[model samples]
Target: MTQAQPSATPEFRRVAQRLRDDVTGGVYAPGQRLPAAAELAERLGTNRSVTERAVRLAAAEGLLTTRKGSGAFVARILKRIPRRAAALLGVPEGSEADGTREAVEAELRDMGLASRYFPTMSTERAPQDLAGLLGVKRSGKNVLVWETRVFAVPIGAQPTDPGTPVELIRTYLPLDIAAGTTLEQTDVTPLDIRGRLAELGHRPTEFTETIEVRPPLDDEAQFLGLDTDNRVVQLTHSTTAGDRTVEISVSVFPAHLWSFSYRWTAS
Candidate 1:
């Protein structure tokens, strides 16, 4: 890709993109030594400082890693595996492996965001629809559940930066299983929770999603690092199993610094 002329976008950003494209376009093969810093600066028609900043940004984005004494080299790229090997092994970042969870957390940390999940309960009656999602009998007693906190951060580490506060999340599961099961053991997602329940003989065949935008609650402000004046984007998802709906979950996100995306294509 050709580099763009510098304007509002930083000179370093343009330099970074050029370097990225060089590696991606095969000009700098995997494991190859990049041009020396001075040489890269000359080639890009910029100074050493701009080139250095670009290299650092690329490294932070996982495109490159630096070595002491030795100059920067192209990061190694593994060869494509055969179909059978690919089927048995998945890389979490690009493949279906469990490592994806850590990858997500790493991305969050890189952006300086914080997250916390806790187990709590709701004494309030499950709404008719939510009760169906959890698969619990409507007439049953009030039950315990899972509550969580999630925070969004800006590009920098400072806490005073503007951010939205959200109520974050609330999840409920059946108490039919022995009481006091550790939260870790019982904290399956709505989709997977039904499967766990089914393993013990329950089936959830229905699910629902409700999304809204609203002001954050007081508790949400404390956990999400939000000012009392901020509002949040809320998503409430419910799932049902058998005659009883067995799971209810709500996820909240700050409005100012959040992004949401989804796409579907022919399978």
Candidate 2:
């Protein structure tokens, strides 16, 4: 039998969309306090609870901010220019697998933009999708998951306000390849995983990347400072040595902050 379709849209989603339209159309100015929950409910002819939930949804999208004992206010949005970056379809001659990140940083530096990499590493069972990518069974096998956030360096800003985050990256490595190595460490490292893998005699001989466009998840939206109406570019990197898949990384870039290009030559 065919699977049934999911349920209809929630009432809060409808309310949220209406509010988003108003905000985009300038009905609500940035930094202006939004109407009270009861007032909004009355205006939309909906219950107060539904209106509150809708406000929360808009807040999650970075379009509104709600203050305790006060009320919701429209957010002052910033427009960030998209930076151009290339994703090579194949490994360029004389280039190592680990050079991509460094290249990106160098390009930004040339444009008077600095970058910092913040990484968090943890040991966990490989998710089913990641297991398949790593050519392993989905039997709750433990693996090393590394999450990294790339942020622009503010010239004279304090650490509390570092700069805008440019991208979010997550890498998965099989236990056999990660155990007893720095890759499994919780501390952030300047060395790339390819360098660590080379030390372990598993240098990848091939690399492939797949790119997709999709809307961000709630957490991703918050991390990238994106609204619900915004989208992101998701790229997957797969590196292999002979028959073994050594690493798989997924990166998410806010659509407004990244522009990708590549050249192709016919055989």
- lDDT against the true structure, each candidate: 0.54, 0.72
Model 2 residue pairs with clashes: none
Give candidate 1 misplaced runs (Cα > 4 Å): 1-114, 121-124, 127-129, 132-140, 151-167, 176-195, 203-206, 242-244
How many clashing pairs does model 2 include? 0
Report the C-alpha lDDT of model 1 over 89-126, residue by residue, as the tens digit: 22222222122224444555554554333444444445
In lDDT terms, how accurate is model 1? 0.54
Error of 1 at 92 (Å): 16
lDDT of 2 at 219: 90
Question: For every model shown, what is its TM-score relative to the native structure?
Answer: 0.44, 0.65
Lowest lDDT sum, 10 consecutive residues, model 2, at 77-86
